[model samples]
Target: MTVTATKFTPEVMLSAPRRSPGVPNPSGKLVLYTIRVLDIESGNSELLTEDPEAGCPVWVGEEKVLYLKTDSRGNTTFIVRSVKSPEPESYDIGKINAPLSDLKVKKLPSGNIALACSALVNPDGELVNPETDKKPLSSAKVYTSLFVRHWDTWNSDRKRSIFYGALGEEDGKLVLLGNTLTNALGGTNLSSPVPPFGDSADFDIGPSGLVFVAKDPELDPATYTKTDLYFIPLKTFTEPQAPAPRIIKTPGLEGYSQTPVFSHCGTKVAFTRMHSRQYESDKTRLILVPDINNPDVTEEFYATEDGAGGWDSRPEAIAWGLDDSHLYVSAEFHGRRMLFQLPSTPSKATQFPKLIETPKGSVVGFSVLHRPGSETTVTTADILFVSSTSLIDNSCYSIAHPGTLECRLISSTSKEGKSFGLSRSQVDSIWFSGAGDYDVHAWVVRPSTFSKDSKKKYPLAMLIHGGPQGAWNDSWSTRWNPAVFAEQGYVVVCPNPTGSTGYGQDFEDAITGNWGGRPYQDLVRCFEWIEQNMPEVDTDRAVALGASYGGFMINWIQGQPLGRKFKALVCHDGVFSTLNQWATEELFFPIHDFEGTLYENRAAYEKWDPARFANEWATPELIIHSELDYRLPVTEGLAAFNVLQAKKVPSKLLVFPDENHWVLKPENSLVWHREVLGWINKYSGVEEEQKSN
Candidate 1:
């Protein structure tokens, strides 16, 4: 079959289907969704709703689906539809008066439904209008605050408040009850979905109608970025007073505690918490509260003890089995992000957690299906699904319950019969022995036009992954795609060396304070392994490129003895000096905890500082940075480029003033690819005709 490369341009988002535990569907069919719903049993799909701008559908009960839809006027309205019914009932929650942020539906034990929403309102308990509401400290033009500017927006006084509203149907029309539970208490900057770093995993509700909020209550972002859990008795009525919210303090006093999940029996609440309050890189451990009402009685629950991706080992998503005896966790390990099952009450002291087998890719999200009266929770396995992607294929599938080995393809619903016009490239994994006798893994994507029988030597491009802690798993990426390099007739090799997650914790921890040691050696070994085993690779014409931590390694690589191996280098948002990078946002924890503060461990910082080894740098380099990237700060890129210029080395600097860390915008990304590709072609001496498709 002739293969062609196609640029993907669809904006698709899928959400995990929500269903009440122990509730029998009776149909025994599974619904996979991606803007449309596919019934797996019959291999048929029916359009639920399509407005071009609609949120994920939430299961209100066994029969009803609730979701938010926005109209052409930019006004959003809530719609509820019965699964078997054709017409949908719409509710206007006065969005113009109090615009909702994160809307969620919860069922109380009393069988009543309530909506938990976040709205940006003023101190006067009214929705803050950007056009009308006066700014805080009206006279001062230059105001000072820690979170004054986060990501892309300036912080304002219009704080988000969690509101509770009882849902019911009156005369066939949906009626909402109760005012904002938090509005009356002097509007707080309480975010339902915490800003900057929080996800849908930040909060959850129990059958008792107790809504738990994981929020950072107006802390100075510069010094502290801590989020604690707070609970409020959900008001299911319009008239009666709502109870004040109470705090559920964890032992990690200064750290964050979030993604609260209530047990099926509501007897236990499990959440993810960080150990240190200020450091985002601190180990994230699972914490269980026997009684959330008495949160201090908490114990450490070890499910991701194998270590989640470098930063932490906390589960991103959680759900309990119908019998409530097993908890399913979606965690990152090795290079793949997969699901794991932890016995609610483990009988053995040394029985490690059981991994739910799936494809070698990221398990983006999952949902659990259980009958109302099942004999055991063993049948309550998560319908673990992964939007699996590799260097060539972009498909999604759900592993069958009971026997996770059965991989069922559900990509039909998502593709909707549209062909990508892309051919699958020849992909394989290669392992090599590296520093400390450790096995390093690298993913190799062969050029689309090449074959093993051709015996042609293809130019190689070694792509380094960032996170120094993050692994290059079998996943699809819009940025740093190996396929793009392969499309240009270059062999791509992405390795997960020491310090990369997914390997055991001991291996990941090896590069904590010693970033330039084993990881560099592993990269060198990976390169040598490829040149030796893969006769189709042209090692003399190879180039190395990376972003963020990967970018840092590129700088480190140029100073190492292996520097001469690469013809050229590309670094984006890379770290140049540890001492100079101390002021970058969100890196405080890892720099302080792992390497100790600059004052305490000056030698460690200087030992691996790329800026210090400028005299040894001779490779032609391309440095890219973004002004909005406070994480690494654009200064790091500027310093690296200045050093190259001063050393009389061939170099070019690309700055994206409007972008952050990663070049996200379509136009900016095009420029990034063109510039980097152009650089590789020039330095590697590849002809113009061979560089483009």
Candidate 2:
């Protein structure tokens, strides 16, 4: 039976990943945005910039601020403003003659700027702006041997490169010095900041003016793509210069290494390093490469041997402590992204890193205000600013300091009291005995009309999360939102089953080569627990739905011995044939998860291949697939639909030609929500009750 959550459960929890398109800015007319600074000591805030497009502010000394301003015509210029003077001057750090599409700009320590952009340059170091180029994309002939097609974009010679130089005298003029870092060999075909997709954090410009960069290692096709660290001296970036990179060798790390960050003193570098060369799920260990007159000495910085002890220990953002002895590392744990303060060097006395108290939600991005010579720093104080969000709210900004109980909220995304006609759902935590008697945690969202004493029993919608390595956390989701089901008068159950993150290392690794084993049992037991114990649920009219790995589980569930537990099932972008998915985009994921190639481990592939057991399928199902979904090719979804149709199990196929793995478009998402809910309503008769009420 489907049961709604009680009132007492607690609530909890993308990074430099280009802010998802779904993120909402305030809905209004074009209002000019101004940069404002708040003083913590005096609780006073003053305007810093009045430019409408001023954003991505970076602190330049004590009283100077550097920010980017983009105009209506897509022209961008960096502005350096002073705060100490009565009339702060805005220094026009003019535009670089490069495509501003997905551009990134960082203020270097030496009063210069480093830009990463997609540009076409001549041998003479002049930018050939595509908008004004004689040959446009329609007329240009593009050729590439590797990564011809990435996540979405087609790669040609117009890949991204790093260019460092100062602004010229003209308002928007750029001075070109050295050649593009990624194009030194005529064309390295390498993406820097690390493409298909990457951010400023992927590379670092140290205080010493040397650029510590990370990119796919130039290797033959036989080897898996491995990212390594390289040193690019700023001095070499002169006229007629070639981009020279000195590779930093890590003896123990054979896997990919990115996110290279240098310490405040520039004597050490910290980056996430994985060990296994070919495994995608390999544990990333945070290591400190000390500058002891050698580029090869890399030592573990965190106390834990395997690092943070979850699905992936690789923290996305790492910041140094003002003292330079500790680092604030952010990683996903138990469905929530948490921040921990760990020492720079290993310590026998400290066994575990300390978790800094944060709002019980995801910490997306943060900036630290070191204030080196300030009064508080004179006595040693920790000061930080964070941007975070929860299920009920959009992102908000806050300030965390030494004296605060929690980070103090400085600004909120929502208006002070304006209601947006959005209703908050009641979500509660539930724990039940899963496979092997392990305690499995899941969340239940109650319909707005549900009451503990009410006689009305609601049908349940079991929502399985995608990442076999991911978890359903206490966070808001645009896709697979539990609130949507709740709004449709169905109680939603989201379980952090086996192999889900935030549990521990062992639990996450359990489903590695045994995909259809314990994780499926965890879902079965989670379903059974709700049916037997919860009196407010209509268990007999439940529908199971999943996407990605969760979608794989939905297919597996239809063939299980207790497959009759659910009335219907919906699988979106699921894997039907494990063997057939070998050609999927990420070769390393399935290779490592299934343990070797499909031929090498035929038994492993057959054990989890849902298509093999189609004869056992009896439940009515709906299959959804997108053409652009490279991770799980659209063929898997089509094959699953073919089986359901052949067996006459009553199925329908929903396909999106333009969308990728996710139904990200606004209209498509609306259709997805309606169709999936409509299928459940048709089978379970839940919509009739809503209409009658």
Candidate 3:
């Protein structure tokens, strides 16, 4: 029996199964990944462990795996299970005293496993347990420096630090060597797996030692993006005392450092670096340390000239090839996040990395797979990657060979969208001449029911992406998804204008100091191009929506001549007044984008201040802000709402007290989608269209 498909709604998207990146075992024949163990050859998957709380599985060897299991009381335990046996062994490392996650394991020379995970720790380097720890006499926090608040959370005494200890068997039971884990950054006044968004990816464990990225303690976190690599040499997990970590400095690369991936040999490290100290969106240059023993020697792979002379796209997450002769890098190219292969060592002959084609989607995550004892041989290796499109949630594939670039499918979650009536054919793209004679790109997602022969006109949902530096890639996103708007009988258009990534460094830099200039002009051109080229779109019933920088642009557009073209607008956590942006925690972002500090660059802020032209905001707008969004702050939304109310403009305000810069919680997100869609539908005549039908 064939069941008719239903409209793709927020509920379907939110209920989709979330799959983690695949981690291949030592032999590459089996995968201990996500929540299930997959047999690569047989194409069979089974539950990794019976315990529901056990997750973040890391391969201990060919047949054994180690994972973390946290109870309802917030107490975490390390569990090691074997594929051959149903019973798993539990290890009691004593009271970690805090919630721990992101488990990583490395084999020690002493035939024991060295385990590491990130945990929130107090000043004295002890794990912080809010459940059992003593409560403060008063709810008060004093700040002497910057970073009083960041992202969504206010400053606290506890820091997210890496805790490590040795795992060995004793008296027929698994136990931590010291019965307690050692804080790697203890007494250093620094945090690893840096706050807000960092995870196990920020650090890597290898045979030689542990290398992690951390911001300089001397500098103010609120104003700088200078995160340096720190290395701690641990020859064996049985060290009596935790050694002091030393900084691995890259002379010219002074910006943010990320994804310090240690080579298979563990003697070297390859990571991405940005040159500009203040610019967060600068080009991420690939950097390599020849030897961890000698930290001073570093080389730049695929080296490009300072400003536009060489290869230009930013390299994201990286992994070492099987033979260590090459590196696999996933980066944004045009509209998709493509994977590329580059030499592990610096090559003067190579101008650009070789692109390795995969499925039609962004390469979200990838790892190199090698057969056991075949690390030195290049023939027995493959690249396992996770790909996803705007329509497909995620699909796992393995590139059989780098030479052939043959991608063999392993598994996929794409079938889950079938019942929701989604298809890849609904997604397309268009390029138009934008400001500064640059060709700007925009994605066009048509409704599932749309047909060229129908003569039906769909309302326009102009989605302006955030980051101003970020692009609307052909990737799956739970937030600001074009498909959701398309399902509501609208033609969703997402533009990658000036200051968007994956294009080039110069194009992205064009909007640094000219926030309301080139980008705005490009957006205007995008709208005009849509009207002129797309016959199926209803320009008269259009709505604009954005968040963060996009939200700021929406507010900016509210006071511009373009505001009259759209029937309504939606701004999520946008900036109201450029002068009051100092209230943001990341001062470096505004400093770099606006050209200077608020006090020193008042003219620049005043030039793009949306508050200055609030009188011109006549378009009916829906403003959404979260109380925890320290990046823009709720006050920004309230300020915009107050102005709209004062001017007697038709507007509505939706506030989420628990959400941050983005609506992350599933329930809250559902509400967000409903309210946003309802507001846009009411103005775009969708509500009227439904009633008339």
Q: How are the candidates ranked when ordered by TM-score, highest leading?
A: 3, 1, 2
Where model 2 places Cα greater than 4 Å from the true spot, the runs are 1-93, 101-148, 153-158, 167-189, 210-225, 235-243, 303-314, 347-349, 371-380, 402-405, 414-425
- Which regions in candidate 1 have their CA more than 4 angstroms from the true location? 1-34, 42-53, 61-63, 69-76, 81-99, 121-149, 152-161, 179-192, 210-226, 235-244, 249-254, 302-314, 346-350, 370-391, 412-425, 685-693
TM-score of 1: 0.85
- Per-residue lDDT of 290-368 in model 3, one digit per residue for the tens? 8998888888876556533266889999988877778888889888998888778886427588888677778877777
Question: What stretches of model 3 exceed 4 Å from their correct place?
Answer: 1-5, 49-52, 84-95, 169-175, 304-309, 379-381, 385-389, 394-400
Q: What is the lDDT of every predicted structure here?
A: 0.66, 0.65, 0.83
Using lDDT, give the best candidate's number.
3
lDDT per residue for candidate 1 within 1-693, as digits (tens), equals: 122224322221111122211112223354525444555556555566666677646556665666667555445566766666466444554344334545566666665666666556666656554544555565554556454555544556556555556676667655554423334223344555666755445666665545455446666655565777766644443424455666676653467677788787766777777666665644566667777667557766643343342323446677776676777777777566777777665332145556776655566666565444463536444454444454444445554463456666654322321233334445677889988767888888766567878876888899999886678987667677776776577888989999777776567668878888889989888888987898889999999999988998999999987788889999999989867656565545445434676777888888888888888999999999999987787889899999999999999999999998777887788788889988997877665546453
What is the per-residue lDDT of model 2 for residues 1-693, given as tens digits with 9 covering 90 to 100? 012223211121011111221111112101111366544444344577666676655444445555667665445566677655468766765564444433344445554545433334554444546555565557555554444445554444454455554322234334332322333323344445665556566667554434444545555322365677766555323323435566777666767676777777766788877777775455677767777235667776543454443323556677776667767777777667777766667542154666766665677766556453543352125666666655444444566663345667655443210121223446676899978868998888877667888898889889999878888876656677676676677888999988887776678778888889988888888888998888787888999999999999899989886568788899999989888866565666777788878778888888898888889999999999998887787898999999899988889999999888788886787778778988888888877875887
In angstroms, the error of model 2 at 11 is 23
Error of 1 at 198 (Å): 1.0
The window of 10 residues in a row where model 1 has the poorest summed lDDT is 12-21
TM-score of each: 0.85, 0.81, 0.95
Q: What is the lDDT of candidate 1?
A: 0.66
Collision count of model 2:
6
The candidate that achieves the highest TM-score relative to the unseen native structure: 3
